[model samples]
Target: MTDLKRLGLHDLHLSLGGKMVPFAGYEMPVQYAAGVMKEHLHTRAAAGLFDVSHMGQVILRPKGDMASLCAAFEAMMPVDVAGLAQGRQRYGLFTNETGGILDDLMFANRGDHLFVVVNAACKEADVAHMQAHLSAVAEVQPVTDRALLALQGPLAEAALSGLVPQVAVMRFMDVAVVDTVFGALWISRSGYTGEDGFEISVPDGGALGLAQALLARDGVMPIGLGARDSLRLEAGLCLYGHDIDTGTSPVEAGLNWAIQKVRRTGGARAGSFPGDARILAELADGPERQRVALRPDGRAPMREGTAIFAPDGTPVGSVTSGGFGPSVEAPIAMGYVATAYATPGTPLEAEVRGKRLPLTVSTLPFHPTTYKR
Candidate 1:
């Protein structure tokens, strides 16, 4: 096996009792001493810290203004990037010619340039694709000098408010570059756990110190990937390789909102991206299969790859992501089911360990997100 890459906080995580595990080619923390269950609940009731430096970060600088930069990105993404306002962030996907998602990303318009964050597993390929396609339109610079940390949960704002007072005023999806006594912190009011929180981008040298300072605050504790996955599942968020991939289109993945209406077939920037015809068709008519939330009856925990069946025992789909949600306190899952059977409360069965477990099509999220919108 190849060696796992270490993030800047490798040593710090060891010191803080993080149970290191291989993830996305990195030696990441799967759970700390708090364990996945407590870690998951802690984030819901209070706050938890996460080291996400393994994810890719980059800055897109255009030869012209932000409009040109947006146009540069819009060439590959279906999002109406050119229309993004300053300090606002949008979730977008890198789509292939067949309309399948290459990777999902978060990009913020910083007034002068675009700041992007991509899933760690696909970042290498994502960056290479952007460089090959966007070179002529903009400058793509990878940000290796920084470490990313997510402070997630209900009291996250209160914990970090002491260091950065302005953060308390920021609303969901807002981005800002704030200066602290420690140094410059590039922050975004966002997180994956269906909670109000911040993703802080700190210089590599200050990563450990900043994390320590944050953990020092009341209700703040270090969390890990195990809880992160369970949390996102409860939020009905897609995990790049599991819930979405090169074989799934954005519309089929239930991510239509990511594409602004202005970029649709009749809109201002229509037909400007890969798989435009097919994607627009699916958007108009709806895809045959749609990703939806599934709540398994009882406590069997319908895991991924489990076959989903109709009342008559015909296979209609398979679970893409599944697990027990600590916050929801039940077995929750998300998968692509035939559109006819995708409505909420639709009865279905999930084949788990050779037994047919009852399930229902439920509206996401299993738990409502408490973003400060």
Candidate 2:
């Protein structure tokens, strides 16, 4: 087998006794000596720091026409890119020609440039796609030397307030460039753990120091990939290769809020993205399948790829992401089922280990979000 790639924090992780596992081609900690259950609870009650440096960070410089560049990006994405205010970030999706999602991403306008964060596994292909389509109008630079860290949980504010007070004042989805003891960094009021937190992009060499600083706080703990997945799932956030992919559309994936009505109606710039036809069609006439949250009865956890069947034993869909939610104190899952079976309160059965577990289709965000704003 090929050796797994390591991130800048590999040594730090190993020293901390992180349980390393292969994730998106990188050897990362799926949990630590504290265990997944403890790590999961720690993030909920305190703060958890995650090393997300493996994700791609790119900068887009619009040379001649910034408006045109923004429009070009909007054409490839479902978000209202042109309407984004400076220092604000928006979640978006790259749709295929058939209206399926290529990937979900986060975009932020940093003063004179545009910054984007993409899934680690899809970064290369995403960059290639952007370069091939945007080279004529913009300069796309991949900033691989940068490291990203997520400080999440209720205590996150207290942990970061001393270093960057401005971060405490910012609302969710807001981004700011701040100078800290570590150095100048980009701090965004964002995170995947469904808690109030910040995602900081720092210089490669300084990442470890910043992580150490956060870990020194009273409630701060170094979290691993296992807890990160469970936290995001409890928050109803989509996982790239699972909850969303090239086969799902932004609308079908329960991400319609990301698409502004103005963009859908072709108000200012019109439909310029790849799957405009299908996307607009879905906008008018709903999608064939829709992503929904599932609550499984009993203690057994339903995992990804578990077949979901109608009450009569007919296969309708399958689980995309699932596990025990530490916060909710129950098993939670997400998946796409036929539109007819997507409504909240619908009853379904998940086949696990040859036994049919009763489940109910429910609204997403199993736990209440604690974003600053």
Candidate 3:
């Protein structure tokens, strides 16, 4: 097997009892001694810190300024890049010519330039794609030496205020640069766990120190990827390559809100991106199959790739990501099924061991989001 990369906080994770495992070509912590269940609950009740350095962070700068940069960048994707205001972040996707997703990402407007965060698994391909199409107009630079950390949960604001007091005044999706003893940390009021939190980008040399400082604070604990997955699942967020992929469209994934009015069918920047024809068509007419949340009444958690069937044994769809939600207190999953069967309270079955288990489709965000906005 090929060697795995270590995150900047790898040693800190070990010292804090993270059970390390390989994920996204990195040696990541799957869980700590408290385990996935407890960690999941603690994050809900208090603050939890996560080392998400494996994810990609990049900066896009134009030859001149932000005016034409947004237009040029907008030509490459379906989002309203020009509409993204200063210090604000928006979720976007790189769409292929045929309406498939290249990768889903979050981009923030930083006054002078754009800051982008993408999945670790797709960062290389994503950067290559940008370089191929955007090289002539803008500089696509990767921030390879920084480390990203997520401080999430209800208590996240209070816990973080001690270090960066001004962050408490910021709303969700707000980005800023805060100076600390270590260095100027690029901090954002955002996170993946359906809570009001921050994703802090610290210098590589100070990642361990920042992580250790946060861990020493009350109500803050080191959470691993295991809890992170379950939290996002509960938040009804998609995990690239699992809940969504190159085969999926933004419409099929129920991400219509991510597409703004300015870029839709008849608007000014309409039909500018790769798959606007199909995406707009899907917007007018719903997709054949749509991603839905499933609630299995039993305790056993069904995993990804589990087949779904109707009560009469006709197969409907399959599970993409499934697990026991420590907060939901039941087995929950997100998957695609026939549009007709993708309604709340609609009954379906999932084949677990040999027999089929019963389930019902439910609305997303199994847990409510508590963003400060």
Candidate 4:
């Protein structure tokens, strides 16, 4: 049996009758006693709190020059790191030599330090890669003592206003150092779900108390991995290992906006990252395959690993993530397919349980996002 690692909120989850499951090496709650459907509806109607402490949090500081550190980091990602303003965060991908994604990460400029959040499963490899390539002028420190909590939904602000009033004013992608009843922490107006929310990074010891305080509110409920997956899928957000991997580039993942034009144009920092040639080529001519959203005709959920077929019934790709979106009232999925069949409104079929279900290519974020900004 594999030893399951527990987060700071493990006891809280168990107390709430959480259905624990092993995920990304952690014993995480897949759903609460209220069930996935109730948790999903709660998040959409009000707020759902998630314990994301299993994710890796790292702090990067420049040994001497911040600009040089930014440049060094930019060489590994396609995002415009140098242009990131203080207290702002951007989603980025760490690409390998062939333009394949190592992991998708969030980079937040915290004035004197840079805060990086990576996938729980890929954290070790990501940190090693950073340490191996970062110049002597930069120091990479892992913040294992911290815990991350995401409070997502329309009522997120209302739930948090009593604790941190400034969080209500912060726009999407904005970060603020707030002095809460617990202690000093970094609260970012962001989340995985396509809703207004905040990601709080706090001292590990204080996480449980904070989570309890949040859940004590009227609109807040404890959510789990199952609902988190469903919410991100409904929002059209990519899951690190599923929607993208070492074999997929940002271009093919429908994440071209993450790459800046200045980085594409050769200059001081242009074409410095690994697989720049292939990435630039794809940027110009488009990728052979592209990630797309799909809507199945029936109520049955199309799950990951389900085969996608062309009009002739030949395999083209496979579903990466799928489920019934409570907010959308239909089954939604995301997958990679040949570029020719990736257009919106293209007719396709997903083979589920030896049965081909009629499907069609559709625009992502199956539901409209309600971001504060």
Query: Could you tell me the TM-score of candidate 1?
Result: 0.98
How do all models score by TM-score?
A: 0.98, 0.97, 0.98, 0.97
| Candidate 2 residue runs with Cα over 4 Å from true position | none
* lDDT tens per residue, model 4, 1-373: 1697888888889999999999999999999998888898899999999999999898899998778888889988877999999999989889999999999999899888788999999999999999987847578898988889999999999998867788878999998888776777789999999989999999876777788889998799999999998899999999998999999999999998888887886645667788888998899899999999999988889999999999798888989998899888899999999999999999998888889889999998898789888
lDDT digits (tens) for residues 1-373 of candidate 3: 2599998888888888989999999999999999999999999999999999999999999877787778878887888999889999989899999888999998999999999999999999999998888787789999999999999998888888887788989999999988898688999999899988999999998888888888888899999999999999999999999988889999999998988988898888787898888999999999988999999967778899999998888889999999999999888999999898998999999999987888899999999999998
Pairs with steric clashes in candidate 4 = none
lDDT of 3: 0.91
- What ranges in model 3 sit over 4 Å off? none
In the order shown, what is each candidate's alpha-carbon RMSD? 1.1, 1.3, 1.1, 1.3
lDDT of 3 at 32: 92
lDDT of 4 at 44: 91
